[model samples]
Target: MVGAFEQALLALMIFVIMLGMGASLTPRDFYLALKRPYGLAIGVVSQYGFMPFIGFLLITFLPLPSAVAVGVLIMSCMPGGTTSNIFTYFSKGNLALSVLMTVTSTVFGVLLIPILLLIYANALDLEIPRENIIATLVLLLVPVAIGMGLRRLNANGGAVTEFMGSLLAVFFIAFILISWVPRNWEFLLTTTPATYVASIALGVCGIAIGYAFARVLRLHPRNARTVALETGIQNGPLAIAIVAFTFSGTEAQSYMAVPALYSLFIVIVATCVTFIFRRANTAAEQKMPDGLL
Candidate 1:
């Protein structure tokens, strides 16, 4: 009974997030690809290349259970979140690039996440189930495509799209809270010390490494800030749902819960990074030339 409820909750959560993601898109969003392409490149490369490497290193040194290690790697391998775009916009980052990045990463994730997870799991001596991979793709890709279709139908111009977009955001938040509260209440209280420590460590490491990489590459401060936030934060609710549903039919290890733990950690880390960037922006503005100011 508990298992069934968990799966249902996860499915609902994914649908809500995907719908929100789709409703937020505009036709010009796709067209803008030709105008400014580098933003998408930066977003995608940092998301796929940098985050996964950090996860691999964290898993290697963290002393976590094998399932937990796999869970972290899978979460790192997943796409950027709609929330990351919001954060990027608020921080004066490139909103268009963030949106395109999220869209492209999600589309690629249909295949990339499963393949990467399978390879990583195999390296850890974990069994890979082909059926589970298909299930993950179905749950993620189906709603995304449906939501995009709905948006495209009303793409010409309408308040309906905007209304749906706002409602989708509310629905996603509610679903995540609902899905989270039931399953995680106990785990939050009883989780091991190592789990908490590792979650914090991973969160901190992701932000610092991502920020330094972007800085070294000479990305604009705004883009660097966005990349750091996107790299540190993830589509964690989706990840948690995937694990809960995919492992429900089998005796999956309790270590699958680590993604949930990491999800919470990412929120904390993102919040801190946001504040830091805001302060940095203030400092930069104060130093601006009189003409610019």
Candidate 2:
């Protein structure tokens, strides 16, 4: 019971930190979101539609236990990264699309993640705790909305936003580092070679499967790249919190580790992939004038 309480507290802290980072945006960000409706929709489709199906399919094929399978599925229900916008800008993809997608994904996550859990938990014969889902939504989405609202209301709030955002980012990272370092330290060190291999394999599979779906849907290259990264980057920290509080010491915890590792792997892959796509886009742009290629 103590472990569960600790885990919940840590998750809450991280969620708050993420929200704080988001609050630094200006009202222009919201207007920018409206400019690229198609890109936003494509991102949503990749997250809410393509990735979940791919996760379900992967879980079915893998030899993982039921708890892990459900864990994988639940992680898939999460949205694209808050930091994906930075990568998208660096890669020279459509910036408006990235921002809109991030906003949409974050909002939808408040609803979809819980519904996915309810469905998936039932499949795994696990009980659904509605309160946990509500708490998570409040912790994550509320701060984001508040930040956005502040930006809209105060034209000169950027400095304050940055201050809060930076502090929150530090808080979130510290919270995770302090708690997770102690709790999962032994597991991190003693994880079998097979476990590392499995983690990488699953991360790769998520990218490949999500990319395939995006390609099939005939999404634009920019959207395709975003989907691929989003698919690869499951919310591992969130999954860990769920395992700790809701199902500590159960088989679920072991399975949940896959998502945790996946989050780390996805960040690395996204950085690499963003550069690759950026280089390609730069080469193509150089061939054409007026940014048309």
User: By summed lDDT, which 10 consecutive residues of candidate 2 come out lowest?
Assistant: 284-293
| Clashing pairs counted in every model | 0, 0
Q: Write the per-residue lDDT of candidate 1 for residues 3-88, one digit (tens) a residue.
A: 57766765675676676676666667667754556656766677777777777777777777666676677777778887777667
Give the Cα-based TM-score of candidate 1 against the true structure: 0.82
| lDDT (Cα atoms) of all candidates against the true structure | 0.66, 0.60
Q: Lowest-scoring 10 consecutive residues by lDDT in candidate 1? A: 284-293
Give per-residue CA lDDT, model 2, range 88-193, as digits (tens).
Answer: 6666665555556656776778787777767656665655565775576666666676766765677457447645554543344345456554666676676555
Q: Which pairs of residues clash in candidate 2, taking residues 3 or more apart in a chain or in different chains?
A: none
Instruction: Mark the regions of model 2 whose C-alpha exceeds 4 Å error after superposition.
Output: 1-13, 21-37, 124-131, 159-182, 185-198, 209-220, 241-245, 249-256, 286-293
Instruction: State model 1's lDDT.
Output: 0.66
- Supply the global lDDT for candidate 2: 0.60
